[model samples]
Target: MTTTPPPPQVVGPAGAGARTGSGDVAATLRATKKRLTSPWATFAAVVLAVLWTIPTFGLLVTSFRPAADINATGWWTVLTSPNFTLENYQTVMAVDSSQSLLPFIINSVVITIPSVVLPIFLATLAAYSFAWMQFRGRDALFVAVFALQVVPIQVTLIPLLSLYADIGVAGTFWAVWISHTMFGLPLAVFLLHNFMREIPGELIEAARVDGAGHVTVFFRLMLPLLKPALAAFGIYQFLWVWNDLLVALTFAGSSNQVAPMTVALFNLTGTRGSQWFLLSAGAFVSIIVPALVFLSLQRYFVRGLLAGSVKG
Candidate 1:
């Protein structure tokens, strides 16, 4: 009867292990919830998305309302106003030769498509040579090539315009295209060269051993693998050319039909202010093509276009 309550029933090893495991699981759950429910991260993301979308949302709402309503009231009053119409878009699209945004859009496409495709082609060739082929002063030349990106386009604009003037090509589509190509090349070469250099040398060696020429290897193997970077650069080039007013205005003639969307939209405004309603509608309209292009090609960026190009 002198036993102290069966020695207080000591915890067995299994029971101790179970209790420790439970404590660890509980701690992990708390840490997971703390991470997931972090207020700062969630708030920052929500705030950024909302801030980014506000202007787009405002323009969309404003575009549907009549000019009277837009000038009279804020876009917030949209729900209060019972009427919505496509008249703004209708009016924007119905411009005459002095202000036809659609033609300008086509012109932008002409400039942008060629600008993008040319650079990619040229860059790919240079990248392939730099990455795989051996030649004199290759590394030194690449460094000089990369050094070109540091120079601002503003610095070159006057010189290029002067050159174009001398060449009797100052105000033409060719001038704009060539200027875009030259401006875009250095970065293009740098990026594609980096991507191509990542390709394993063994594959190039094997392809060479199989009697495949450089052009054949490039088209068959490297071209397919470069899709992601090509898409990325293509989209970037298209956007730059589409949005560029300076080069288009400088190199492309006002008389020439190839004055791009930016120039067209710029002239849409009067000295006092734009036809705000028209400007908003035209602005959105101008963005539509680039948005579609970006969406179409964006998937290529995440895709591993280089998969299986080399052995592990």
Candidate 2:
């Protein structure tokens, strides 16, 4: 009766509970941060980074060293002796020589672009279907496709080659293109499907409710969200196809016109193995494009790899 009993004292556990919860959260976050930045963790990371970088550093040093110097001493000797030259690169890239890698470089680009594009394009469609579409035997079919990744490419080479021959496309760019597409599809589908499944079902349902068809949803909604995943897979496929020796040798070895840089580098070893400088230079040449590609898309690569790792 006296001033409404001072608003009923207005006392409860609500404010105390919130403060306690926030304190716990902050304590947990601080512990996590401290653990991540601990000295042992930093040391381990540094050691691993150095171990991985040494060989590539050696390769770079060897690539620039003169042929005589390369054969006589290790790449590390460059720190004291300090000798370098561009002759190795010159010899490998010289147009007048039969060892010229120019044509093979061009061939690699041709083979790689289509090989990367075809699988990604097809796999995106397949992944979308596997993830969102409700059809009979869908799960069984997805498992079957996933199982193909375990099948060795070596085992399939002969049969695939025979099929290509029967179709009269063997030893042609078409054969290599198709072979790479087939070989790349299984992993591509698996990866993209996992990523697609991570996306909220409500978004797809909302689009459908608004009269957007599969094609519209895929192009307009899914594609933008899928950029990181696509770039990650694209980099992986690009590197694999670019550095591939066995596949190129098997499918495109019949002619220089179709063979990629790996095939050319292989021939360099067979024919000019004694020339250490040429091998080093060719190795660097083969790696440059892939390195650049990886660097350019590295942000996307990391994001793509983290897809489906956590849910909120």
Candidate 3:
């Protein structure tokens, strides 16, 4: 052209929005790096890590020690003697003894799976209804559910167990599953509802404009976005149910087929308890799955917590 075209005018809103987004990302990255590199933060993290690892390391070493050595000496002595055996693991895993923990471990798996899944599934639906649907009393209902969290599980156990007994489901896995689901629901719904409300309304509107029904939108859009929240709650429920001894004792303790590993491990600590090695081995056995799960999903858990804390 004879004259250079007038310099193009830059759009304001789009560029501003992009710059804002990048600024937020950069801020977050800088914050993370600062926290990681700070001497005090690094020292605190290492100290806490060492504190946690010591007990676990001791338990693992004790598990490997011979029964005689475990009874006679502290686990720290292993560094000097270094005498280890797998007999404890073999003894605890054996099926012949009435005290063998294998069957109870299986029962734990059975109880934990349903207890975690049912609450999350039901809670997601309830949370969606509360978050997005137009329904009278939605806020009130959510508050009521949130309020239930203050009520102790101890208060509910007696009545709940009695109801289970009347219904003839007492001492069965059903009782434990139902109890865990009920106890978990209030908190689950409260948490998931909060997370659901964080989702961009424009996305939901666009989905609706495309003729997607509630169910379709939930499955295709919300579910994928909700994975972090779900994983966070899933991990919490898994650890709670897996480690719970009181609930299991009340409902399923009488039935060997339904009792969990906690019940079996508790049995090892009672009168005539001489199986320190077995207890140590059993502790690690029960711990392995939960540790693996936490390691695998920890990223999602942390992200969910951060997202929940911040409003987009």
Candidate 4:
């Protein structure tokens, strides 16, 4: 119209801002839901978890069932009969020399403790040197060490066994201990070095400014912050050493005195393999320690994983 029309009413800033905020919130919620429950992704995750858990669950069920029941039908059939017994575990824990797992359990403890401790302790020192100390060819040395991860354990086994034999340490706990230490060092140092680099340079500089030496800085400053990483790596090395068969077999052999639980468990399956109950119970018995270690350190492991995501 030719006549001046009323000026168009303006929307208030607050109203527009609120509307935008709501839209943003809705979009964020949608994205979160999409990530959490994409149809195919959800299905795949469920399927994978089920596939992984079924075997472990079956093993646990089989461990408690009577030998007759286990041989008569599959572990799944236990649901119908509801039979349970502790005799399998009793046999596994018996004091008899042939069937007793006590000595092997003790051996695993002995082997695993040193294997875990020595590597972590040595790795910490090496990692600190690499991450902080100035030296010629430090980077080259670190790269070379990291590259050692590519070497297969099998490839080194013959030479390592020979070397152990030459040193007269073969067929003893020392062989497994030192072998694990050497094999575990490179990866351990790499992981610890990377983690050490993630510490704030400012804090380190401040410590240096306050008259703290490298040793002081490492023990007083770095080690405290590295607890999560240490716990994570400890769990990893524990599981690896505990579950290891090839290394134990190669070094410790069938000698019940030095062989770990894994070797003992392997011995259970002889020519006939008739002792299904013993095998099941023995398997669960061997699993208990690692499971406990994981459960006890799970928090640290998760924290370590998240902290590792941060860049240096």
Number of the predicted model whose TM-score against the real structure is largest: 1
> Which has the higher TM-score value, candidate number 1 or candidate number 4?
1
Clash count, predicted structure 3: 0
Q: Model 2, 1-312: lDDT tens per residue?
A: 565545423223333344655565666667667878998999999999999999998988899999888999999988888998998899878887876777788899999999999999999999999999999999999999888877778898998888988999888889889988888898889889988999999999999999999999999999999987898888778877888888889889736689998887777778745666877898898899988887888876565444312211
N/CA/C clash count, model 4: 0
Residue pairs with backbone atoms closer than 3 Å in model 4 (clashes) = none
What lDDT does the true structure give each of the candidates?
Answer: 0.78, 0.84, 0.85, 0.84
Locate the minimum summed-lDDT window of 10 residues in model 4.
303-312
Relative to the true structure, candidate 4 has a C-alpha RMSD (angstroms) of 8.4
The per-prediction CA RMSD against the true structure, in angstroms, equals 9.4, 9.4, 10.5, 8.4
Greater TM-score among 1 and 3 belongs to 1
Off by over 4 Å in 4: 1-49, 299-312
Error of 1 at 120 (Å): 0.6
Of 3 and 4, which scores higher on TM-score? 4
Give the alpha carbon lDDT tens digit for every residue of 166-229 in model 1.
Answer: 9888887889999999888887887788888888889889999999999999999899988777
List TM-scores for all candidates, in order: 0.83, 0.78, 0.80, 0.81
> After superposing candidate 3, which stretches have Cα over 4 Å from the reference?
1-52, 302-312
- Any runs in candidate 1 off by more than 4 Å, and if so which? 1-19, 39-44, 95-98, 253-256, 299-312
Candidate 4 local lDDT, 1-312, one digit each (tens): 799988634333333454664565666667667877889998999999999999989989988998898898999887777899998898878888466787888899999999999999999999999998899999999999888877768888889899999999999999999988887887788888988999988999999999999999999999999987888777777777898888899899887789999998888787384688888888898998888877888876564444323211
Q: Order candidates by lDDT, high to low.
A: 3, 4, 2, 1
